[model samples]
Structures are given as structure tokens and as C-alpha cells.
Target: MKQPNEKPTLKTIAQVTGLAAATVSRALNDAADISASTKERVRLAARQVGYRPNRAGLRLRTGKTRVVALVLNIEDEILGIVSPLLSGVAEVLEASEYNLVVIPETPAGDPLKPVMDVINNGMADGIILTRTQPYDLRVKVLTDRDFPFVTYGRTDMKIKHPYIDFDNEAFAYESVRRLAALGRRNLALLAPPPHLMFHRHMSDGFRRGIRDFDCMEMPLGDIDLDTPLQEVFNRGRKHFLSTHRADGIVAGSASASVALLAGLEQAGATIQADFDMVAKEPARFTEWIRPEIIAINEDIRGSGIALARTVLSIAAGHPLQSLQQVLFPSD
Candidate 1:
């Protein structure tokens, strides 16, 4: 029996259940050599004694830290999207022994460095990468090392790996088509940083939509992701005040849409009357704010779940196809 001040260990449970310490350990770990009846007895004894497996001891035995690393850019962390994504990831990881560790990267620093450190040091069993570039070096390195990793976005590089990407191109194209249908000829698109791989997809979609709809794109509306929110709003206000004011706008994100709306309101521009706007955001946000503002629901939480599952699968030695998912707005 364990004293009141002593924490319950496998040895305590083994003594209480009259089983060998090695047998108790194997049963607790669900080793194939342990019979089901013995495993049940050991589990019951562990519950009675409140025995908990030591994580450090387990790592030493299995060579697996049982941790998952999620790497994100610090700038993107401020956008208020990380919460729901994290919630989804947590929901999936809670079902297993795995735990999540977040690693934030600065804009100027090498984002791949933290990922490499985690891999080389065996700090985590797998990794989840975000804000992927067109030719991401992290993807190349991880693939070369044959480490278990999954990306939140697609890469332009030829190396095929597990990934989950939202369809920015299709969303942009549809936003333009919807605006053009409303008889808005002069249009503008608020885009992300040009260095992002998704930016290429968004730009391509916007250009194709302009050609298809026979509309003009305001050159000044190209906003980068790194630009301050207030600056984005100020730029929109200035543009709307100019003689070349666009009659319609397509914002890449809800934050961009809000900034543009604030600018338009400051300039006394009426929505749907003087101008129209469409944005990509979580469906619930647009519903709660202004139902009239057309929005394409980007499922960030779903993407998180997919990323979690992919990395876990890779870690488990399960062969999987490279996953490419694109979500559209629901009516």
C-alpha cells in the first residue's frame, strides 16, 4: 500500500494486485504479450491506486516524446484565427496520448529553424507547418529527412507531402463573379502578401475574374498581410475618396473587409447602394455582423483537424495520400 504522501507508481499497483512490476508495466502499456484478463486486473489496480505513467520514463522506453509541434508565423497569430484552429487541433489530440506544442516564428527569422530543431532534437513525434511559401525549404528538408510532418497550405515545389489548403483562387473568382452580377463594373481586390504561395492563386483568380467579367481592378487596392490594420483602413479611405474609386471590392479576409468597411463608412459610402463588398471569413462571423455582406466561409477549424489527423497518421506509419482540401462558403 502507498503512503498518503507518496504518489502512486507502477510498483505500488503491482504490489497491490500481487503482479510482478514488469507484468504491471507491460499490462499498463497494453503490450501484446499481456493477456486481456491480466491487463484488466492491472488497470483496475492502477485506478484504485491512482497510478500515472511517467512521461519521461515512457519516452526513454519508446523513443517517442508523444508530442506534436504546430509552427505559425507571429503575424498570423494576431489575426484572431488561431483560437478556433487550435481548438480543433486540441479536440483531435485529446483522444490520444499526444500533446500539442506551439512554436511562433518572427517575420524576419527563418521559420524552418524551429521545425528543424524539433525534428533533430526529438522534441516531438510530428510537426504541423503553417504559412507555407511557394517553394518552401521546410517541406524539402522534412521530405529529405523522411520525418513525419504536415503543412497547412500547399507548396509549388514538386515534393508531394501531406497538406490542407483552402481554395483561395476559387473564392476570389466567385467573389468577383458575384459582384459583377450585381452590376458593379469597377472593382478592387484586397490581397495578402505577394510572397505567400496562396497569393499567387488569389492573384490568378482575380485576374481571370476581371477578364471574365470585363471589370477593371484598382491597382491601389493590393494590400499586403504585413500592413497594419489601421493603414489598410486608411488606404481604403484614401482610394474611395479618389476619382478612381471602385464601385465594388473583394477582400481576402474578414479583417480586410472590416477595414475596408470602416474606410467606406468614413467616406460616407453606402454599402449595396453606393458600393458592394464581398469577403472570405468564417460563416458565423458574417452572419453575426452583417448578413448583407456576402461572405465565403473559410473553415479554419476543419483545416486544423485535417492537419492534426495527417501528422498523426504519418507518425503512426500509415501510408496516406497527400491531402489537398478546399472549402467554399455555405449559403
Candidate 2:
């Protein structure tokens, strides 16, 4: 009998099940050649002994890490979207033997270094990429290497890699249509960074909504979603000081919307009285802070889970074509 405090291993399971260590390992891994009865016996013994696979040993034997690398933006983490996204990915990984490793990178810094590191070092079995551009070099490199990766955002590269993207076009159109229904003719859009594919989608939707609604564009100055929160606040402080006015505003994120609202309130501008704002609610906190501002839900967590599942399937030798998913926003 094993000591009560002793950690369980394949040898321990084999000792308990009266099987060879190799057979126990093959059964634990679900090897095709292993018989069902033997596998069930080994698994039952492993469960009884609380046996767990050692990742290092597994990698040495199979040349696979059983890990997934998640590449997220620093800004997204600062804005509080990282927790739920990570939770969702970890939720899926918990069910399997895989683990999650998040690698945060600056928007302006080299995003390809971590990816290349993973490829050269065999650091992970799969990867999750984000901040996808229309002509993304990262996507091109990964596709060229025939790596197992899935982007949380869409890309327009000729290669067909796996992806799970939000419906930015639909979000923009719905925001505009909702604001228009509220009788706001002059509108402005707080867009995501211009270099991303989602920005182009939003721009297309914004133009279409403007033309369809016969409304005038109230352009917000040089800043975008990537700008610092303080700067967005500073801009809002002086936004209403001038004669300019946008009766309705649509911001890309809850953080940006709140920053704008905070500065506007500090500058003595009132919500609903001065202007109405609509923003994407990935975390569902905008209404809690300010009920007057309209909030729309974005499925950030679901996107994370979808990306994980797709990449895991691809790494397991499944095709990527059937795994592409695009989530549409509701409310």
C-alpha cells in the first residue's frame, strides 16, 4: 500500500492495478492499441490512487507540451477584460490536460517575438492570438509554419486560419440605429485603433448607418480606443467647453465611455441632459456606475472559450474551416 502522504504516479497506479507501468501509461493516455478493459482498470486504479500525469514527463515522451499560449494586449488587461477572458479559457482547459499561459504585449511593441519564441522553443501545443490586423504578419507567419493557432479577432490575410471574432459591424450599426431612434441626428463614434481589422469593420458600419439614417457625422478629434484613459478624460473636459456638440456619442468600450463621462461630469456636463452615450459592456459595469448611459453586452468570455476550443481541436489534427465563429452582440 502507498503511504498516505505520498504523491501518486503511474508506478503507483500500476502497483495497485497489477499492470505494467508502460501499460498503465498507455491506458491513461487513451492509446488506440490499449484494450478497453485494461484502460478502464488502469483509469479506475489511477482514480483510486489520485494519480496525475507529470507534464514534464509527458512532453519528454510525446514531444508535446499540452499547453496553450494566450497573447493578449496590455491595454485590454488594464481595462479589466483580461480576468473574464482568462477565466473562460481556463474553464475549458480545466476539463482537459491542457494549461493556459498568457503572454501580454504592448500594442506598439513587437507582437511576433513571443509567437516565434513559442515556435522555436516548442513552448506550447497551441496558441491564441489577438489584435488581428487586415494584413497581419503574425497570422502569416503562423500559417506559414503550419502551427496550431486561433485568433480571437478576425484577419483578412489570404490564408484561412482559425478565428473567433466579434461582430463589430453589427455593434456599430446597432448603436447608431438605437441612437437614431432616440431622435439624435448629430452623432460621433469613438472607434478602436485604426490599424486593426475591427476598426475597418466599424468604419464601414458607421458610414452605412450614417447614410441609412440621414444623420450628420460629429467627428471626435484625434484620439481612439488605444489612447490613455487620462487623455480621453482630458479631451472630454474640454469637449463641451467649446461651441461644439454631439447630441449622441458611441464609444468602443466601457472604460472609455466611463472616462469620457467622468471628465464630462467634472466639466459640468450632464448625462441625458447634455448628451447620451452608448458603449460596449464587456464586463457589464457601465450601467451600475451610470444608469443614464446605454450599455450593450459583448460576449468577451464566450469569445475566449471559442478560441480555446478551436485551437485545441486544430492541435488535435482537426480542420480549422468548420471552427470559425463570429459572435453577434445582444442588447
lDDT of 1 by residue, 1-331 (tens): 7889999987898789888998988786657788979888887777677666676878899877878999876564433467778887888876555779998887678877998889878888899998889999999999999888988888899897888888888888998999999999898888878888888988899889999999998765546666778888888778878999888888887777877788878988889998899888854676577666788888888888888988888887877765566555544
Which residues of candidate 2, in runs, are more than 4 Å off? 1-5, 11-24, 27-52, 76-79
TM-score against truth, every candidate:
0.85, 0.90
- TM-score of model 1 (CA atoms): 0.85
Return the TM-score for candidate 2, rounded to 2 decimals.
0.90
Error of 1 at 107 (Å): 2.6
Best by lDDT: 2
- Cα lDDT tens digits, model 2, 181-293, are 98887888989899999999888887789889987788678878898889989888888776776888888888888888888889899988778888987876777777888
- The residue-level lDDT of candidate 2 at 242 comes to 60
Error of 2 at 194 (Å): 0.6
Stretches of candidate 1 off by over 4 Å are 1-53, 76-79
